[model samples]
Target: MSLDRPAGKVPLLELEGLVKHFPFRDSLGRRRGAVHAVDGVTLAVPRGSVLAIVGESGCGKSTLGRVALRLVEPDAGSLRFDGEDLLALRPAALRAKRREMQLIFQDPFASLDPRMTVEAAITEPLILHRLHRGRERARVAELLERVGLRPELARRWPHEFSGGQRQRIAIARALASEPRLVIGDEPVSALDVSVQAQVVNLLGDLIRDLGLTFVLISHDLGVVRQVADRVAVMYLGRIVEEAPAEQLFLTPRHPYTRALLAAVPGQGGALKLLEGDIPSPVSPPSGCRFRTRCPHAQALCAEVVPELMGDAGRESAGQAAHLTACHFQDSLPPATPIREAAADARLARLQSFFSTNREPTA
Candidate 1:
């Protein structure tokens, strides 16, 4: 059933100066280095909205999502959920509070227990949370149908389903507890292009109808654009730009954000891909982490780190809060259009295939 509650203005999830690092040792147990996975990430997620964290694979977007849930602990920083300090909670308290938040992993196959049937996988959370005790089977069937699967399929094993079906099952398991906040760590990246759309649409319906707050960690700009209400562009473990989704794409202030949008297919000119791989987090570049690949980087960029500044003076009320961490955000050149006229027809066909055959939202 669709949730009847309306989204509130208060932030549901807040992260302030969050930092997480992993120390590595050599084969002989000698200290080697530390991987600075999530470094000083501060952001607010309002209740019942979708906030997407987009960037390249090694940029620590995934790590940030995991840290929020305490699946991986942070070395430093404050984590607050619904006005409570998550980091300050005791182990027992934290575990009890977990029902309010949940994670939908990227690899559906690896995330599920192979031995468990679809019903068992989805029912486990209900048992743990002790909800609908006498009617657990009815709850499982309802969840399966909610995620676009047949109730009869609940008895099937994970391997018996298709890639898309497995992902649907994973989502059903995550929603079993009726979490208020859901973090999808590259949830649809593993599926084929055709299947990705179906999952994306399903997620959109769920978020809107259920009034659930979502944190989507992904590298796909198209998927991000389709579902996100706001976008946060991450580079080397820090947010470089954040704005309403349309504003971010239409007027990207960060050089890194521009390069990502420019690379999208059918969007018009030559692909302006960011040069070079991401720097090692163990020894990241000084000053600005993106300076190594930014075409507009100058000597000052290397000498001083830039803070994420808002565009209060230049933008109107709603969009004025757009933030960028570039020293020369005002001087950055406009992006060259990258969409091709020839690609429009193909893009339309692709869109149609994914939009069709999905169950209507309740």
Candidate 2:
């Protein structure tokens, strides 16, 4: 399923100057300030790549995913999919274009319709797009098996399945339209740890087998490390750093990114905890949103915003440039590197556990 895409083609998905804000109002109907969910996000996802957006709760990771799929429209920005302008598509055109994109929601428990059987649920997409017109049940059965569920289970109710199975069904439904891009918003977070590993492995296999351009939104670094090709670290609705997963984990340049890595269990660096609570998105800190919690904050960090800096010519061809947004990144003290051997060993153990047939370990 992994196709060789032509070189220098337009990205499968591209977002620029994206902005979304939720406004609150009193009973008086006066509009209070808005919650700045996403502000000026720009990124590209090449075909067949897994781009993970990682951040703490309310940092706009999920919002960005929703916006990318246009499930929640952005207040401002340009969205291009396969060189076509998504934002400019008319309503009917947008609906037709939606067949190429889909979303797997965070909570599998609530994602399914309680009233609908698994067959009906998965068949909804087929009906919407007028696909497999006379053989919907067979299609549902195929989808169930694709996600590692029994074909017989299609007739069962969602409540009859466990959390992991429910998530598998959700995955099947998202793929019913055979979308080219899928945004998984914390798809594994609601499941238990053992189940999480199984779902993560399934997702990885599907991405490789289906050649999906996937966007995974999660705060779980372990899962991100396992599946992501590119990692974007978001803070207070702004991306602080983005790079290839290995480069970001091994040589994180932004102080915020370093602190996040330091908190991982096997990172083998002196813990570098962020000092303060994240600033409220309603009124995020000026200049740099992370300066409030960033250990390397200086007078300049308060006065001016830093652009995401990277040398385009330095990286090997075809590898993404490692970009970090910090004015003093060059002058800041070098971060302690994560011990590679320990990290590799831990990752190896995790992969082994995922591959084994034995019951999941506690």
Candidate 3:
């Protein structure tokens, strides 16, 4: 179901200056260093619309989702949901808010308990929130049907269902609270290609029918393209680009954004391949974290970290905002012919060297 208009609406959930760091210490429990899991992320999920957070694995995409629910306590930042401070809420208040928000994890198989029956699984949240009893079992069956599963299947164990069916059960559990917001973390990535589409469409239907807001975290660009109203592209621990789905697919401003788009299969009529590995987050490159791999990068890109700034000329001048963190957004600057070319030459030479070194046996 498509949103009527994605702009001019207040976000159901908002994050400002959000930061989370994990501690890794020496043997004596003394501080060693911190993993910069999520760094200064600020974004929003508009009421009744889907906002997709797309990035490669370990970019803290999952961590950000957990932080949104206060599942993992962050080292710093502000989180607000419908005008209430999420972080400032006490334990009991937070639990009450939990009823309004729920997360659908990435792996259905891993998320569900093998020991519990489908009915028990979905009913667990009900019990935790004190929502049901003897007669409510019939309602559980209704939810299963709503998610396109048979009510009879509820009596079976998690292992009895196919991958797609198990995921349906997971969705049933997430909807148990009749939550206002649903955070799906790579909800369909684990399923077969055909199954992936079915689940995606199901989610879209649920969002529209229930008037639910979604914060989707995914690496499947195609899925994101299919379901997202707006998109945020992450690198390392920060959002480097954010814009409406159509605008991002068409006129991506950042070179890193362009290069990331390089891997999108179709599109990119004659662009180069994505050139390098994401640097280790522990000791990320100076300036733009993506500068090490971005093809159009210059010396200045390596020296000064560009902040997320919007181009004055983008499509949504009034409502939609497009922000890109790259100094070269205004113009493709001159390059220093990075050491990458030399490395490429060496790789070709090495491949040829190994080919020649192989003896042609008689």
How many residue pairs in model 3 have overlapping backbones?
0
Candidates in descending TM-score order? 2, 1, 3
| lDDT, candidate 2, 194-286, per-residue tens | 899889989998999998999999999989999999999999888999998988988889999998888778655456666768889999999
Judged by whole-model lDDT over C-alpha atoms, candidate 3 comes out at 0.83
The digit string of per-residue lDDT tens for model 3 on 247-333 reads 777777777667666666644242577667888777678898898887777899889988887878763556477888998788864
Candidate 1 stretches greater than 4 Å from native = 1-8, 267-271, 315-320, 338-362
Q: lDDT rank, highest first?
A: 2, 1, 3
lDDT against the true structure, each candidate: 0.88, 0.89, 0.83
- Higher-TM-score candidate of 1 and 2: 2
Better of 2 and 3 by lDDT: 2
Supply every candidate's count of residue pairs whose N, Cα or C atoms clash at under 3 angstroms: 7, 0, 0
Query: Tens digit of lDDT per residue, candidate 1, span 175-254?
Result: 99999999999999999987998899899999988989999999998899899988999998899998888789887889
Supply the TM-score for candidate 1.
0.91
